[model samples]
Target: MAKVSISLDAELVVEVMVLAGVGSPQDAIEAVVRDYIARGHRTEARTELKDEALRELDAKPQEPQG
Candidate 1:
């Protein structure tokens, strides 16, 4: 594992620790980081799909309505 140093609000850190029922700051930090990374991946995938749909739309010609 890698060691990273990040500064967070003291109150926010305490809240996360209490909610997670974790004794150490590291455990709370790890849980938050993991959730953030997972959500990021999901967002990226959605963005890519949206872009692809836009491209397909742009490639299609509009049809005239009677």
Candidate 2:
């Protein structure tokens, strides 16, 4: 993978490091990013399941009216 250089606020980096419990700023940021991506994937999967269930309900035959 290619590496890129960027500047970030020192305070923000320290906060992230503390929250992530990682000694290195790079590892802290990376951990947060990976967690965010995983959360997004889980949310998307749940949405897909809900959509599929709705479609199935729509496709089911209804009882005739009295």
Candidate 3:
């Protein structure tokens, strides 16, 4: 674990700690960061899949039926 110090909003940190139900500021911050990363991954995957689907739709030839 790396020890570094940065300033944050005191009120926000307190709110996060209360919401996360964690006693320490470090734990609350870690949880928030982890959630943010996971959400980004999910969003990226969703966008990739959507792009692939659009490309596939454009590539497929439409059949004409009488």
TM-score of each: 0.70, 0.87, 0.81
On a 0 to 100 scale, what is the lDDT of residue 54 in model 1? Answer: 100
List the candidates ranked by lDDT, beginning with the highest.
3, 2, 1
lDDT to native, each model: 0.93, 0.95, 0.95
True lDDT of residue 17, candidate 2: 98
Cα deviation of 46 in candidate 3 (Å)?
A: 1.0
lDDT of 1 by residue, 11-62 (tens): 9999999988888988998898889999999999999999999999999999
Better of 1 and 3 by TM-score: 3
Q: What is the lDDT of residue 50 in candidate 1?
A: 100
Alpha-carbon RMSD of each model: 2.5, 1.3, 2.6
Better of 2 and 3 by lDDT: 3
**Model 2, 1-66: lDDT tens per residue?**
998777899999999999999999999988998999999999999999999999999999999999
lDDT of 3 at 5: 85
What does candidate 3's lDDT look like per residue over 1-66, in tens digits? 877788899999999999999999989998998999999999999999999999999999989879
**Winning candidate number (TM-score):** 2
Instruction: Supply candidate 2's per-residue lDDT for 53.
Output: 100
